[model samples]
Target: MGLRLACRPLKPIDARRAREYAKHAMPSVHLTRHLYTFFPHLEGQHLIVEASTAGEVVAALEKLAPGIGFYICDERGRLRTHVNIFVGKQMIRDRKGLTDAVAADDEVHILQALSGG
Candidate 1:
């Protein structure tokens, strides 16, 4: 006998509501003060962005500071060499893809690496 898996598709109305909720739900993003050394305007501020994925959050941030995306990610959209992002206490796994899922109340932290002679 073959095993059958049960799966149910969401109804159109349900799907629409889910999309609406995802669009309205916002995540809190925190940027390290060190980044302000590079972009003064972004200093000491917390931003709320409606995003379900790490990449979307970055895109939302780009709206606040043009070219900020380049600092966090490379031209190809992969994470840059000196930037690190964490959701709560865990580091994101897909730095290149930024596919990590973020909850509405999740805290996203953006940090810039520091080097000294």
Candidate 2:
């Protein structure tokens, strides 16, 4: 089952608003046709994936924020540029691929990298 992502710390956004946005932001099924065919279980709302593993959680978060500072990788093994993902004490640089194992109690964090003049 997918998660009802809590939005307590989502700044200007709340859970209901965030969920609605996520529903609308879902990528077209065609875009991920090839991959979903193989991982069919990931076809739809699976976008809001939840796991006891920190690695799994980070990977899911990256997909939700595929942009600069949001390192998301498709199943094709291509890393989305400009994004960075971190899990607790570790920083992830491998976007094209990652297999880090996660535990149920581990916390997953997703955020954009900041640059200043």
Candidate 3:
């Protein structure tokens, strides 16, 4: 499913508000890698996408590799425990909701978190 934003004529005040909103919105984000085990076809390639949120970025990735999202996340749309997603230097706070904010220059890294006994 996709979301379509309806275009409408804006009044002077609304237009100003829209401009302000656009200023805060990031234009794009970079995906460093798509973990080989999960996305073999896109393993080494770095993908640049236009998305404001982490979820949107994953959705864009799904377009490139079908069922990719399922591998990274569960049926409830939560990030798997073994999967680690970082937007820039900090790890995302809401793993389950994926409501983390992402910027245009931010590097989004998705990789498997390894552990040993």
Cα lDDT tens digits for candidate 2, 19-116:
78755542121122434444455556434345433345544554654431133444464444533445545655555555554443333334334456
- The residue-by-residue lDDT of candidate 1 on 8-110, one tens digit each, is 9965668888888866777999987876777787776668988889999999999998988998999899998788899988888898899999899799998
Q: Which residue pairs show collisions in model 1?
A: none
Decoy 3 TM-score against native: 0.66
lDDT values for all models: 0.87, 0.45, 0.75
Q: Could you give the candidate ranking by lDDT, starting with the highest? A: 1, 3, 2
**Best candidate, TM-score:** 1
| Deviation from truth (RMSD, Å), model 1 | 10.5
lDDT of 3 by residue, 20-101 (tens): 8766655343333435555687755657777767887787888988997887789999988988778887888889888898
Q: What is the lDDT of residue 25 in candidate 2?
A: 47
Better of 1 and 2 by TM-score: 1
Candidate 2 residue 2 C-alpha distance from true site, Å? 51
Clashing pairs in 3: none
